[model samples]
Target: MSIASAIVLFMVIWFMTFLIVIPFRIDTQGDLGEIVPGTHAGSPQNHHLKKKAWITTGITLVLWVIIGGTIVSGVISVRDIDLFGRMGPEGSMWHSESGSAAE
Candidate 1:
């Protein structure tokens, strides 16, 4: 993939990981019996956002490396997922196996 696509993929992965990790090990106001006067009890008392962001970045980097390597090495390609026969030399986009376009 191009650098732009790789960057976008990394961003998406990082955000997804961040959201998934946000609730882990959180200290909610209600859980600690320190609910602020007006805020909801479920509000996080110590979100540790910076730490979580770093962890998310690390996880995303590892995932990106594996995915990028697979893509670069051609372990998986677009034709591998063309379940409807819409691509490749013998698919809809090209000559079919019967050498007919109508098929």
Candidate 2:
């Protein structure tokens, strides 16, 4: 693949990673139950947990962005190609005796 293609692939992978890392909250009860429920029920702990979860999520996102950017840039600089290139006859044994095989 080309450098551009590699960058695009990385972006897609990063997006998927972001989606998977973020947590979702579901409320089975109505708003009244959420605000003030009966005894032995859920409490403000959920809110606190959600806040901490968001903080951790934000940190993870920043770290991934930095790491991914570094890796993509390094790969682009070193390989000069985004993805692996097709192998020639010298690199692969599948070529015919006539050496006419092509990618």
Candidate 3:
């Protein structure tokens, strides 16, 4: 893939992984029985964002390598997922071999 495409892929994977990782091991104020006077109890007591960020980066790297390698190696291509015969032939990028536009 191109540099921009690879960067975009990594960013997507990183953000997705961060979102999924955020909720894990969370210690809400309500769960700790120490609700602040002005803040909601459901707020995080201690986010530990630094540690979480490190963990997320580690996970993202591994996933990015595996996914990026697959894409770079072309082990799985768009044609594999053309459930409705969209790409028609293997080498065609956008149009099908039968002169039909991808629906």
Candidate 4:
């Protein structure tokens, strides 16, 4: 893949991993029974964002390496996923064998 594509792919993976990691090991003020006067009870007592960010980065890096390797090795390709056989020369990006947009 090109540099731009690789960078974009890494970013997407990182953010997705971050979302998955955010809800884990969370400590809300309500759970801690230490709600501050001005803040909502559900507010995070300690986000540990820096730790989660590092974890997310590590997980995303591993995932990106696997996916990028597959892409480079052609273990998966657009044609392999063209379930309707709509990715050949006779078909446009969105066209299927019926000569219309793929469902």
Q: How much lDDT does candidate 1 score? A: 0.87
Better of 3 and 4 by lDDT: 4
Model 1, 1-103: lDDT tens per residue?
Answer: 8999899888998899899998898999999999889999999999999999999999999999998889889989898898987564733465655676665
Which stretches of candidate 3 lie above 4 Å from their native place?
Answer: 91-103
Better of 1 and 2 by lDDT: 1
Sliding window of 10 residues with minimal summed lDDT for model 3: 86-95
Model 3 lDDT tens row, 16-89: 99999998898999999999999998999988888888999999999999999999999998778879885556
lDDT of 3 at 86: 55
Mark the 10 consecutive residues where model 1 has the least summed lDDT. 88-97
Per-prediction TM-score: 0.82, 0.29, 0.83, 0.82
- Compose the digit string of candidate 4's lDDT tens values, residues 1-103: 9999999999999999999999988899999999999999999998999999999999999999999899989889888876876465644666555666555
**Number of the top lDDT candidate:** 4
Q: What lDDT does the true structure give each of the candidates?
A: 0.87, 0.54, 0.88, 0.89
Query: Candidate 2: deviation at residue 36, Å?
Result: 18
Q: What is the C-alpha lDDT profile of model 2 across 1-103, one tens digit per residue?
A: 4678656655665556556644445333353365545644433324345555565566666765666677656744433452553343345656555566565
On lDDT, who's better, 2 or 3?
Answer: 3
Question: How large is the C-alpha RMSD of every model relative to the true structure?
Answer: 3.3, 8.3, 3.4, 4.6
Off by over 4 Å in 4: 89-103
User: C-alpha displacement of 22 in model 2, angstroms?
Assistant: 12
